[model samples]
Target: MEHVRDSFARQKAMTLIGASLASLEAGASEIRLPYRADLTQQKGFVHGGIIGMIADSACGYAAYSLMPASASLVTVEYKINILAPARGSLVARGKVLKSGRTLTVARAEVYADDGTHVASMQQTLMMLPDTPDTPE
Candidate 1:
């Protein structure tokens, strides 16, 4: 949706790192983040923490896309598995599994440009009441 795309465009980190929204439909979103020297760890591989952050952001945005404009969400818990060392570019795809009035559960997968499965993550997001100034 245009709103989602606009919101993503305004995200400084996503913009600065060149993360792009490849696709979005229903309650899912696919994002791509190219690996640059800045994304590398001291050993020259993509940092594990960066991988987790991508997964988290992907899932969070996917979940947010399904909610009513008045509802806001935040990650309450996340579990991630690093299957292999990440190098080069990465793609993250997220999908919403379930959504309730108070919680949403989502899953995401991170893959290397070579199509290797690098990591996977699942997160639980809590819906919070929004004040007038921060309405969703």
Candidate 2:
């Protein structure tokens, strides 16, 4: 949907990491990240933190897709497991596990260019209805 695409496009963090929204549907989304030397570790594989970042956003977007138009969301907590060394490009697929009025649970799996499973994540997100500006 336009709303989802627009929100993803406005995410500066995704742009900083050279990631793109590959596809999205209600309750599901995918992110593609190109491999870059700056994102790798000494082992020449993508760092776990970078992997976690994309997985987190991937799940977050999935949860957001199902939220009401007037609501915005934030990650409450997430657990990610790195399964293999990530090389080349990566694609992360996320799907909502449960959608609630106030909380949503989502999961994601990252795969390497050759389709090697690289990481998995489960996340909890809190949906907040838009409100007037509040003190930060």
Candidate 3:
């Protein structure tokens, strides 16, 4: 998963939000983000958009983990459900449900620092198997 690690490291969005690649394995991946005031919505909880961002990336990377080294991916669509007010640090666990040649399905569940399920996301990712990643 070195490529996965490298790709994630180069993601400016993740870096901007202070997210880190916590773990990565075939068909599964995890991302972690520490709580920050700038990430909060008006109600003093993490913003829904930020939660979706991490969830999408988590699922996208999970699908990418199962693809060929040269493959590039894009999330065609994703549906996210925010279940609770997120506080403290967050962990998003992503798992691949199905891996196809050109389309993949994956899910990501976000948990609060206390382990409460705060959000869930499922995404459809399109893979370009012959496309290579951009240089860092």
Candidate 4:
């Protein structure tokens, strides 16, 4: 839990978006973001890129939470589908669909505060090999 929290604290984009971890568990995680005008597109709705960012991090963190203490994780691939206009506060929840030694697959869903599904994501993450000089 400490590692997960610390890792998230280091994300500059997350900090800029005012996102925070809503929950963290062995193979699941949730991120929350309050609506901010700066995050919106010309349509006055939250931008799709912001939706993807939170969804990507949510899935990445879910995989990271399950990785060994000495390991770090990186997103290798992810696909997101934007379903509806994102309004108000948002929450993205990620769950690991599969875990392997070198690869992990996860799914995530972004929802508006009132529980409207705004976007969905499927992600693949790779475990990074540590170099002798590097630390997790």
Backbone clashes per model, in order? 0, 0, 0, 0
Model 4 spans > 4 angstroms off: 131-136
Q: After superposition, how far is residue 51 of candidate 1 from its true place, in Å?
A: 0.6
Better of 1 and 2 by lDDT: 2
Compare the candidates by lDDT and give the number of the best one.
3
Candidate 1 lDDT (Cα, 0 to 1):
0.84
lDDT of 3 by residue, 45-92 (tens): 999999999999999999989987788899999999999999989999
TM-score ranking of the models: 3, 4, 2, 1
| Predicted structure 2: lDDT | 0.90
Those runs of model 2 whose alpha carbons end farther than 4 Å from true positions after fitting are 131-136
* TM-score, prediction 1: 0.89
Model 4 residue 107 CA deviation (Å) reads: 0.6
- Candidate 1 lowest-lDDT run of ten: 127-136
- Candidate 2, residues 1-136: lDDT per residue as tens digits? 5667777888888999899999899999999999999999998999899899899989988988887666678899999999999999999999999998899999999999998999999999998888311223
For all candidates in order, the CA lDDT equals 0.84, 0.90, 0.93, 0.91
Comparing candidate 2 with candidate 4, which one achieves the higher lDDT? Answer: 4
Candidate 2 structure, TM-score to reference: 0.93
Off by over 4 Å in 3: none
Highest TM-score among the candidates is held by which one? Answer: 3
